[model samples]
Target: MSVFVASLAFGVISASVLAIASIGFTLQFAVTNVLNLAYAAVMTASAYVAYEVNQAGVVVWVSALVGAAVGATMSYLLNRVVYTPFQRRKASPITLVIVSLGMTLIIEFGTQAFVGGTNVSYTMANGPTLGVGSFVFTGAELGIVAVAVATMVAVHVLIRYTRLGKAMRAAAANRDLARVCGIRTARVVTVTWILSGAVCGLAGVVFGMNAGSFGATSTDIFVVLILAAVFLGGPGEPYGAMVGALVIGLGTEVSAAFIQPDYKDVIAFVILLVMLVARPTGLLGART
Candidate 1:
């Protein structure tokens, strides 16, 4: 029972980080209608930025801030310079996905060329571990979870309360209608990119802190897992993403307790497949 509890806590912690990353990815997809394959590269890029900031004697939170800034900026730039132009040319969904894949490869290879193909660690500014029942977590881990929950709440509030958020939803629902409604669809799209980027960066930093260290491949795999969670939860459903990520995180960790740790990934993926088979639209997605 203790082991079970331990696994459950671990799963929640994992879900927390995954939620941040997937939320960003899902938000971008919701607004832009593109499943960005290059998102992992952005996460890795932000993690490296955080590492460099920490190495320069900045605090961990400061590093995270810097990372978030980079992510937000990068996403804006990508949209302004690449996607926007492609969109102007009336790119199709498949074309956007392919373009994102190309972007992903370029970013990954660029990182490898610049940073070298190697793993790096960002040790959590060492602190005491807190335990609840059989679950153990460090101050840094809890901080990560807090940040995720806070970000999600913030997003919910923004969408529910703010004018800008309403504009974003309008654009997502129907770009032409949003434009007709004078919602500034282009600007909203830009804001969506920036917001998505910042969360992605935060996700990268928090996950790096939580897991100790990672290389490009590790981060990329994590991004893929996040995408799966987002898809399972329903791409445009923010709260649904949280639920799906939590389910995947728990399923993976608990399964790992009895099976080879390596198979844990397979378990999460299998669940995603099963979910897709049962409901093609996703747990909370529209049937469109």
Candidate 2:
């Protein structure tokens, strides 16, 4: 019973981080139709930024904000400079995917060159642990959960109620139709990039904090899990992403009870594979 409870608590924490990252990823696919292989690189870059900021004696929350800013800036520039030009030239989706893959390689090597092969950790003091029923989490872990919930809620509100959100939905549905309706599709795309980028950056920092130590490859490996959740939840659907994250997070953590801890990540991949074979559109995604 205690083991089950602990696993559940850890599952929630994993789900929280995965939700943030997957939401950002799916949002980009929703608005821009780009798979963005460079997303992992952006996450790593943002995590590094947070590390540097924390080293400067800044608060973790503030460092996270800076990391988010860096992500937003990097995403915006990538869209404006690389993806946009290719899009303007009417590049095929495959070509864009290939381009993004190349970009990922560059960013990964660049990061490696800059940060070297050293594993770095956040300089954080341990916080008080709080237990609810059988589940226990530290103040920091609870804070992470809170932040994830707030971010997800904010995204939901933006997409469901606001005029800009309606525009984004229309654009996602059909860019030509949205532009025909004078919805300013370009502006909507830019906003999408910024929002997704911020979420990605924030996710990266929180992930590092939770893990205790991370290196450049951390986000690269994490990106696979994020992609799995994004696809499983249904690409372009924020709510679906959250649901998928919950399942993946819980499934992986709980699997540790029966299987070797080293196989935890494999569980996510298996779930993803099953989802792909059974329902390509995802659990909540409507078939196009």
Candidate 3:
């Protein structure tokens, strides 16, 4: 029972990270209709940026901010330089997916070459351990959960109350119609990428912190879990992505406590497969 509880605690941490990453992934798709296989690559690059900053003796939190900024910049450039050109040419969705996959390879390998293809860890302390009954967490882990909660709240307010959020939603629903209705859809898409990229960057840093180490290829597998959460909740549905992240995070962690740890990712894959077969539209996704 104690072990179960401990696993649940770990699951919450995992879910927090997944929620951040999955929401960013879903938002990019919702606004731009881009699957962005390179999203995880962006995460990896941002983390490495943070790692460099930390090595320079900057605080980890401050380094994370720098990473987020880099992520936003990189995302904006990718959209402007790569995606926008293809979009102007009316590229097919599959073609864009292939392009993103190619970009993923380029970014991952490029970073690997630069970082020497070895595992690296942040130079930050986990701080004091805190326990509540059967649940235990370090200061850093708690901080991660707090950050996730704050991010979710901020996202809710952005989507529910802000003018930019409304415009984003409008553009996502029907870009042509929104443009006809006088919304600057291109601007909205650009802003969406920037916002989502920031979140993606933070998630990458948090993921590395939780794992204790990371490399260019580390997030490649983690991307699968993010996809599972996004699809389980519903593609392009932010709220649904959060729910899916929680489910997958908890499911994988608890299963790991009982089964082999090596199969944790397998558990996520099985859940994703089941969800796909059972309800392709996802939990909150409207049927097309």
Predicted candidate 1 versus true structure: per-residue lDDT over 109-130, tens digit per residue: 8877877888888745657788
lDDT of each: 0.85, 0.90, 0.91
TM-score of each: 0.96, 0.97, 0.97
- Runs in model 3 deviating more than 4 A are none
TM-score-best of 1 and 3: 3
lDDT of 2 at 100: 94
Give per-residue CA lDDT, model 3, range 1-288, as digits (tens).
Answer: 478898999899999999988988999899999999999999999999999999999988888888889888889998999999999999999999999999999999999999987899998888888988867689999988887888788888999999999999999999999999999999999999999989888888888877889999999888889999999999999999999999999999999999999998899879888987888999889976
Better of 1 and 2 by lDDT: 2
Q: Which 10 consecutive positions of candidate 1 have the poorest summed lDDT?
A: 119-128
Q: Pick the candidate with the highest lDDT.
A: 3
* Shift of residue 112 alpha carbon in model 3, Å: 1.0
**Residue ranges of candidate 1 with Cα displaced over 4 Å:** none
**Ranked candidates, highest TM-score first:** 3, 2, 1
Which residue runs of candidate 2 sit more than 4 Å off their true CA positions? none
